[model samples]
Target: MEIYQLVFETAIEINPGAVAVGAALGIVVGVPLGAAIAKLVQKRAERGVKGTARVGRLRAKRAWDA
Candidate 1:
């Protein structure tokens, strides 16, 4: 058999129900993984902003005194 025929045959052999179940499982797993990553990134950004603000305040205080 040719490679294209073999590939098509393999695809046909897999059940549609199985494919749907796999897709559902992937969505279930992916949503929380994506949300957790977004939450982590947001936290890091907030922390960076706080640190920058603190440094800016310190600089302003020194400038005011001098």
Candidate 2:
């Protein structure tokens, strides 16, 4: 087994602390984004249900008239 290390002063430095903070920030930002998406999906589902009910009512009325 051999380990290779590259030391470059011009390379971008990656700090573990910064990565952890970025992960935490991503979760903080994602929670509300997820909630907003869920709300939109919920509204879309409700609209679908309402549209189905309206179609059902129209069908029933047509059957009754016939």
Candidate 3:
């Protein structure tokens, strides 16, 4: 057998196991980080909306006074 053929056969043998391990690791590492990031974004958005509302209230109160 040629050297290239041997290498190809070895690669084919390894591919499925490599892919399964990689997928398992990705799911293990990805899910919690994704959830934490989502929570942080939600809290920041809520704070931003509250701040906007406060500013709007101040502007309306000032306009009413004027």
Candidate structures ordered by lDDT, highest first: 3, 1, 2
Instruction: Itemize residue pairs with steric clashes in candidate 2.
Output: none
lDDT of 2 by residue, 1-66 (tens): 122223221121556566667668989999999999999879978777657678789999999999
Which 10-residue span in candidate 1 carries the lowest summed lDDT? Answer: 7-16
Model 1 TM-score (2 dp): 0.48
* Greater-lDDT candidate between 2 and 3: 3
Worst 10 residues of 2 by lDDT: 1-10
- Compared with the true structure, all predictions reach lDDT values of 0.81, 0.72, 0.82
The residue pairs in collision within model 3 are: none
Best by lDDT: 3
Give the RMSD in angstroms, all C-alphas superposed, for model 2: 17.2
Q: Estimate each model's TM-score.
A: 0.48, 0.50, 0.48
Candidate order by TM-score, highest to lowest?
2, 3, 1
Tell me how far candidate 1 lies from the true structure as C-alpha RMSD in angstroms: 16.4
Off by over 4 Å in 1: 1-13, 49-66
**Total clashing residue pairs per candidate?**
0, 0, 0
Candidate 2: lDDT over CA atoms? 0.72
TM-score: which is higher, 2 or 3?
Answer: 2
